[model samples]
Target: MMYKMQFPKIVLIIIITSTLAVNEIRFYPVEAIPDIKKVPEEYPTIQAAINAASPGDTIIVTHGTYNENLLVNKSISIIGENPATTIIDGGQRGNAINVVSSGVVISGFTIQNGTGGLPYSGISVSGCNFVVINNTVLRENYYGLQLTNSNNSQIFNNVIMNNMYAGIYIHDRCSNNAFFENTIKNNIVGVWSSNSPSNVFYHNNFINNTNQLQAFPPMILDNGSEGNYWSDCIGSDIDLDGVGDAPFAGDRYPLMGMFVNFTLRYGSQIYFLSIICNSTISNFHFDRSNGKISFDVLGSKDTVGFCRMASPLTIIKNYTVYINDKVPIYIGNWTVSNYIYGYFLYLHESEPQRVTVMLDLPKNENPQSLFPILVATLLIVTALTIIILIKRKGKLDKNLS
Candidate 1:
């Protein structure tokens, strides 16, 4: 670590002030220099856009039904205008979108109608790394997602249901892949993995499936803090921490409630964290200015509500929980994963209650919470000095006369 005395005072102050400045979150979007290719507007088809686009370009598909099987061979981002109306049907043919390139991001689309077979899916990946598939819908396909020899990929925030075979099929030594925050419902099998080892699965809801897993590989069902929520889980949360006691299949710490994920952007970096709550969590706010992460939790008056938080280690090193502006009697914490895990319970009412997580960053790095107080003290000192100077000048004028 570098010493602070070696740096200038003004530079350090600027860094701290701007790092957690009020109302500055999500302001500086990284505007890349890549060419943006619009579908049907610039190329008339998505395939045409890919054919003409260079690597690192972005293809934006507007709101409409597009009947085409896309094969992406270059590193690019394909974003739909909206997942509900941006439909990409494969006409009962091959895969809806086959990705042979790494660093690919496909989001906000409803991909369906692929041929009913293994390796043919709404989104198929082969030998790719750093690929992200999120904010999309995959239904009525042979496999909602198929990953072959893919590693370091993230699959989250997608409604993948009613598939013919499995919602996700992974094989051929797929390792280090993360599957989280997805709703895999009404499928023949939720996930089928063979010859794939060391793949992590968490924060996904497995509901109403004939078979949840038909596996031949070693998988981590939990992130050491909490696991995915299974509708048919036999385990129970005895300690009221929103985590199950016994193991369900392979998840030792299954979440009692559905996992909710939030994407927060500060400056150029994006931060991701998840919450497992019995209440309807909304109005989530991350105020680094005051070192408080606040949110509104709502539920019926008859039910008791609780929220389990999985805070990223990069965001805050420690935190305190406050419910409705009062500190609760008990708050549970887990020393499991690299991230900070904590939870608290509250009595539900007609109005939504506010919960806040007062953050404590690492030593000397978090220059927040005290900055405002220091500014106020500086203003007071300046005002007192001005008043004394004015009185002294008046007395000096009288003495001169």
Candidate 2:
């Protein structure tokens, strides 16, 4: 005797509805939102639009000069028309732009003439989790990119030249920041850090600066087989691996010449990797899910080739690199950490070869509704159990007969 239990139809509907509701709670990234506010057309000034705009809004500033200091205290993007034509003059007053809140992006603006005293910079990032990319910080009175107590930030693809103190400065308490593909040249100090650790820097061109790198306490510069290219690195590549034979002070894999290429794609937008001082790259691909890349090209002899890609993963401690579909080898290359935006991977190549890359969606993107799946799985299992029970009961009745 097998008996079937009756279930309420309303209960099943409620369960399905609740599962759908839970899945409907979606948190979109900044790139997913499509609301864009134009400058001068929608609002008179960048700050004015910021004041009127809400979070997750984008402000596009057209080609022009804005003679004013900017203060960004909200989570938004301020994109300029072009880094060369679009300019933000500080009027020789204070920092050109001061970011006080996280989730802020300041891109494609030439920030100049931030004059005051020591510690003032063309772009001062005091908030955590911000992006300062594709901008020119030139002739600032103090630092070009200043990170004071800010953590989880990214400074990329910016020409930080002719600053008084340093091109890039990371003071105390600022950890887990990343600097890549920047041309830090002609400054008194190319890159300086004081009592700050866990900061990842690579693929940058430290060229023509008075002092290349000045860390109060000596710090490691390479993430494994990849590092920045310094114009003053006296080491040579004897084995033709494109990596320096001897350590360049703190950098282990210092390049003989400047050359690097990297790109990042999230959602539908594709961002070309920022180029540092002077170098060229051939081809590249990255597997964001596995933190690996398929490196296909290194420059021929006398040239150093590098290709890299970044993903939404924040902690990229190591990479398993593959060359021409060979066996994958694990490399503990500390590319970048908590890199405000995502994880970045780099590889050094020597010869030109056809490169192929496979990138996958992030692990957490459009997560499936677990509740529904789980309930469906349970229903199947329960039905199987009921069938087995019914068959067994029928056999028992036949035996009894």
**Cα lDDT for residue 193, candidate 2:** 90
Kindly list the per-residue Cα lDDT of model 2 for residues 268-367, writing each as its tens digit. 4454432221224444555555544454454445543343333333333233434455422321223335321211223334544444444333555434
* TM-score top scorer: 1
Question: Which residue pairs show backbone clashes in model 2?
Answer: 298-349, 298-350
| Model 1: residue 93 alpha-carbon error in angstroms | 2.6
Local accuracy of candidate 1 as per-residue lDDT tens digits, 1-401: 13224334534455555454433456667776799999989889999999998899999999999999999999999999999999999878889999999999999999998774444798899999999999999998899999999999999899999989999999998989999889999999999999987999988988888998888955889887678888788666778778888888878888787788877664445777678887878899887567678899888895767787776787667769998889865687765557777878778889988898887754544467568667655655655665566568768877999
State the lDDT at 372 in candidate 2: 66
**Global lDDT for candidate 2?**
0.67
lDDT of 2 at 126: 80
